[model samples]
Target: MMRYILVGILALMVLAVGLLSFEWYRGQNQAVAFGAPFELVDDSGQPITEKAFQGRPTALFFGFTHCPDVCPTTLFEMEGWLDELGEEGEDLQAFFITVDPERDTPEVMKTYLGNFSDRVTGITGDPEKVAAMAKAFRIYSRKVELEDGDYTMDHTASVMLLDRNGDFFGTISYEENAETAVAKLRRLINEG
Candidate 1:
């Protein structure tokens, strides 16, 4: 009876693995999608919104200029993927929206993003506006005080993708390969 029970458990485990593998292979549930809207200030200080993304698919990342690792790393990876995409990249817009608006003024955003891909544009605004924008995008962010009285932002590190119509597209994982991102962008370009 113990042997039979073990066999049953083994069979269930195999079935579970098979189902999960199939789901992964089918490429379903790859991202949490949102068609949310936002209003913030552009690098040039113009008021911006989803209207800016109407004609092209966009990748949006939320963080602050103070992030030491994940923020820059993700921006670099996105840059690499865009480089690999060539012209297809031209049809896409990339945004770096700041959660720490107090310190991420338009000028500060410009200088910070200049260190990364020029293809990306940075946006910031008042604290309330920033909070509303983050909420609209379903982004979670908060300020954390370090031991030295300095502060850093803790935020969701996911890259959000939106289609040309400013509709919910799919999200690209931080660990996703450049090829995957390129393929998704190509699909969006073709579909756009």
Candidate 2:
């Protein structure tokens, strides 16, 4: 009986150590996997992969057209920065990807994007594809049912910025100013 108890304690210690090691490895991997490879369609109906956004630094935002506030506000802010960029911002690409692929068709995207600058490309495709792309970027989004029986999307409100070589660069806050935003782009473009 004494021997059995000693062996059992040893086994439990090994198991606990193994579980801790696994958790440590997983945490490291997830942070490194951000902005990994993805394949999705653009607003133009053409399928775009991670490679398409290469050759220029890109800013990516995931949101829905029906969003009453943050989505449009963020887009508008980014558009202002892009517009003010002029020739300097030409090498920068801003993307507005839709989380609500069901209602945000290519036409709908174009019309909605029209209110913003043409520099921001709208991306939408099959629902599964959209979800996969969001996953690759580590974006969170959910559907909330409203009292009117309709629903709205609650999505991650941050924008991801990638370097010209398609590597994970940094992020842009919705409240960032034009000067700070422009500085980030210039740095990324120069780095490339």
Candidate 3:
């Protein structure tokens, strides 16, 4: 009987240790917040920081105003998603960060973003600052020279979804299905 009790106690101790180890491993592996600190300017030339990404859920897109298709299309769809969500998404905020800061000044961003939802704010700044911000967010952008001595940017076309706490949540790919995209936004607002 004593032997059985000792074995039982040993089993219980092993199980306890296993459970604790699992919890500890999970805590270690869980993501530590998202995004790096940044100092940039909004369309109105206001100093904006990573703090803008907090306090409310954020939909952040990285693209250049000169993008021929993806940028405008994504912005239009983002506006629609916001409109579709309506009051439900009142707590949500959207941002457009320029990857081509050399050509996209604050004034230019203001004019370019005018065609999108007023809820969407444009972010641009010094080229180096913008590049650093893009790198921190894992956004890829490169300039491609055209035959006419002009240039265009090749950039990531996904919109990053961040929770109110500014943690990485998910993304909305360019030209994502409207229903699926709206559903993702709704989920972000409702759960994030």
Candidate 4:
């Protein structure tokens, strides 16, 4: 009886391993997918969609123009990285999507982004649409009321890297090392 029980356990273990291996193989063969559908406008008020992110690697950042530090710093860093990459990064695109659409309109976005590389475009639109887009992109954003009855925005500070097919590849933290950031961008360009 003990030997029979041991054999039964062995058979179950083999069956489990086979099932796990099949699932793993299926997952490996599945295509990678990320984010949801979104429709917004660029700084020029041009209708932009998820299709813009396709056909090339993209550096996507979400922040408000009113951002005191993180937004401006990330924009500057992005410009530098793009400049550093030169021709190699020509195919790489950068987009700045506003988390505070109430105050960051197309005009505001265009003027603000003017300080950075023209290669970097700004995206904004109706508040509800913008919120939906942000949600679909899995970005976190909230409004903070100040003592002056004013307001500020708290949002994600990382720059998301997307492959040529617009799949989420990785991210560069707000203060990620310059060298490391550049390396990640380089890898995205080459691999995507």
Candidate 5:
């Protein structure tokens, strides 16, 4: 009986160590030391700055209009969360930054975001400028050529959450549902 008790204690210690290691890994991955400030044109051609989004919780997604699967699904989920927020949703801002800047012109961005909530803002800028912003956000994107001259971009699908002070708070993976996403945002907002 003493031998069995010792083995159980050892197993529990191992499990505790594993759980702590996993949490540490997650914290390291999500840690943002510093992010560069950027200026980009919104769908309305209005200049948007990192300062403009300060004092409010912001959720940012990197995507393009031609995205075949991920973009639409993510946007739909985001819209549902916005709907759930109701009037207080106005306190939150959603930004869709296009990786395919060549084709995702301001006009294209405007049209693409039309179906969603009015709170959603689509942004695209010169290729070089967009690339710089993507690097700042630690977003990875690559273009794949098609049969025609057209091309498609594969980009990171993680949704970044920024605190009211414009600091990087955390990110919600694509696997998170609207409710989970909202819960995280609420916690961040309240904490700020």
Candidate 6:
């Protein structure tokens, strides 16, 4: 009877271990599947694809040029991060995707990004395409009208970090300091 009890306990332990291993594997697979493919026109009106970002860490943000405050602040933070990274910053690419595609034409994108850094790239596309991409990235952006004929966009102010293989590594909140963001980005690049 003692021998039977020992055998049952061993079987239960093995089952538990198997279940834990399966769960871990599932979690890893989900992480690997984080990002989806997207296509848009770059500042120069050239077609850009997920393949373009492959083998390089990418920092992605969604905003419009018409943004009054948050957008410029975020871009300035990114510039500071690049300065912190120095030469290593070249290895990382920054993409600014405009949520207000109706107004953010390729020319506008180019000019807006130029204020931050030449290293920064701007992307805009058809409204439907931009909306779909924003949905995929879980970005929230909405247009808010003001007394003036112009409008402003209210968007989530988080920067997304994509791994070298174009997987969604993680994000840095807008509230984070430039130093903190740079450290996180460097760690992501090194790990990848």
lDDT tens digits, residue span 1-192, model 3? 999999999999999999999999998877554579999999999999999999888999999889899999999999999889889989999999999998899899999999887888999998998998898888999999999999999999999999888888899998999999999988888883
- RMSD values for the candidates in order, in angstroms, are 7.2, 7.9, 2.6, 3.8, 5.2, 2.7
* Model 4 stretches astray by more than 4 angstroms: 1-33
Model 3 lowest lDDT segment of ten: 27-36
Q: How big is the RMSD of model 4?
A: 3.8
List TM-scores for all candidates, in order. Answer: 0.79, 0.80, 0.86, 0.86, 0.80, 0.86
Stretches of candidate 3 off by over 4 Å are: 1-29
| 1-192: candidate 2 lDDT, tens digit per residue | 999999999999999999999999998975676665666678888877888778888889999999999998998888877777778878888899999999999889989998977878899988988898888888999989999999999998988888877778888787787789878877776775
Query: By summed lDDT, which 10 consecutive residues of candidate 4 come out lowest?
Result: 29-38
TM-score, predicted candidate 4 vs. hidden true structure: 0.86
Worst 10 residues of 2 by lDDT: 30-39
Q: Which model is ahead, 2 or 3, in terms of lDDT?
A: 3
Candidate 6 Cα misplacement greater than 4 A, ranges: 1-15, 18-33
In the range 1-192, model 4's lDDT, one tens digit per residue, is 999999999999999999999999999866545677778889998999999999999999999999999999999999999988989889999999999988998999999999987998999988998898888778999999999999999999999999998888899999899999999999999993
List residue ranges in candidate 5 displaced over 4 A.
Answer: 1-32
User: What TM-score number comes out for model 5?
Assistant: 0.80
| Better candidate number, 2 or 4, judged by TM-score | 4
Which segments of model 1 are wrong by more than 4 Å? 1-37
State the local distance difference test value for candidate 5: 0.87
TM-score of 6: 0.86
